[model samples]
Target chain A: MSASLKSLPSNPAFTLPQSNDVQGTTSASGPHIPAEFEQTLTLLTSHRSVLGYLLLSRSQPVSIIRHSGVVFEGEQGRKYAHAVGRIVETVQAGLEEVAGESTDTDEIRFMRIRTKRHEIMISPDERFLLAVLHDPTS
Target chain B: MSASLKSLPSNPAFTLPQSNDVQGTTSASGPHIPAEFEQTLTLLTSHRSVLGYLLLSRSQPVSIIRHSGVVFEGEQGRKYAHAVGRIVETVQAGLEEVAGESTDTDEIRFMRIRTKRHEIMISPDERFLLAVLHDPTS
Candidate 1:
């Protein structure tokens, strides 16, 4: 597989020296992620199959909140971010169309795209979107 | 869930009176689908959770090869088909962009997008693309 084994924190814009302790702490990234979420991130990266994950703010401009894994770094990371946002938007629109018109409760909950090499799992909340890339065969 | 329970054959263009056989038979659908695939379809529809499936040919004008389930019927079915094709194309392009350039071996094998109500499983081959919609909670 082309994906790297080690998980790394790769934020494109902010280069602030961060704290290693995740207990009850927030991400240094743009959004004020909850302490529970930060703890969840700690738990997610510990798994063997999880290659990396990207957390994004779904507000205007769509910024990255936090990311893990080498595949979620630099230019490749940006592409993944863009694709995750676009796919969620597209699928939400498509679902509305399928139902004949837009409805308030028709919000998307989760999505998983499995490629030949990796699986991209996404979860969307009111303010945040999380995309996790994992190798199922691992 | 809004999805209907019964599985029905829903093809928009050609609705020939079909043969209801599973043993060593080809589909009445176009593009010469193999007997093994038709048998597989039979096996798939037998499952309790699988609400429906759509099989499409990836030719110049993508056409529906075979479809099962009420969610895959009529105008709604058309919407699903169009969305499936578009999503596949978008994801493929996104993968290429992630890789920085196009490669021959970067073909998408499978994709699963789980919405609040349904789960869509897609498998792409050299000639056909199969999309199966199932209720995971069921």
Candidate 2:
């Protein structure tokens, strides 16, 4: 919580190599779910007890992994979830261009999205984008 | 709308140098609204015509900017905006630790936060965090 802008900034290119330090976890193929990650998600979900949360990659046609949170009302939450992914992707692409084309400017890292009924939290990586959905009211 | 996990992966390490390319921007103290940044926000606000938006420094106690966008509801909205900044700070801290401690297994990039009546969009940086609020139902 004491981090300053000088301390952390986002890179324009998404090119981090995934670490293979995960152990005792089985993976069928790509992107192993680290024990620490699952633990963090479990802690957050239980402590926050949010409406609904999801873990999706930032690539095109986002792939969602483990997700547990309240379903947005009207099942519209699903659409909103998908829409949010696309929107963030677009924004990232734009920011990348802006960072390189114009000049070293606003190096955007993560984005916080608030709608009428949802609070979408998005965190980025060179490769993946993590989004969490919660109804702040509940 | 077509971002896939394989297509987009997180980059390793949180190491991006901050840019000092801001020009012709005078700082009376408060928040130094860079000319280009201000222009970008203005364009986004004009095109989106979103509810009032704010740019608050991620530092403790929070430093707010004279921002554009649709104004938030009333006094309550103002308080919520402040609260949102703190909440995001906490979340980012937690996420940062997760990224470093857990290994590159899950390199989280961005997060989307949703509440009962409002939607908050957050963009992160080592230096600053950007947050946008809007009514999802509206």
Q: Find the candidate with the highest DockQ and give its number.
A: 1
The residue ranges of model 2 lying beyond 4 angstroms of the native Cα positions read: A1-30, A72-78, A100-108, B1-138
- Model 2 alpha-carbon miss at residue B20, Å: 39
Q: lDDT: which candidate is best? A: 1
The alpha-carbon deviation from the true structure for residue A15 of candidate 2, after best TM-score superposition, in angstroms, is 18
Each candidate's fnat: 0.59, 0.07
lDDT tens per residue, model 2, A39-69 = 6566556533245556666557766655675
- The C-alpha RMSD in Å for every predicted model, in order, reads 9.2, 17.5
Instruction: Evaluate model 1: give its TM-score.
Output: 0.75
Candidate 1, A26-104: lDDT as tens digits? 3474456666577668767886778888988776556787899998998788888998887777777777777776464
Per-model i-RMS in Å?
Answer: 1.5, 14.5
Shift of residue A14 alpha carbon in model 1, Å:
25
In terms of docking quality, model 2 is: incorrect
TM-scores of all candidate predictions against the true structure: 0.75, 0.40
Please state what fraction of the native interface contacts candidate 1 reproduces. Answer: 0.59
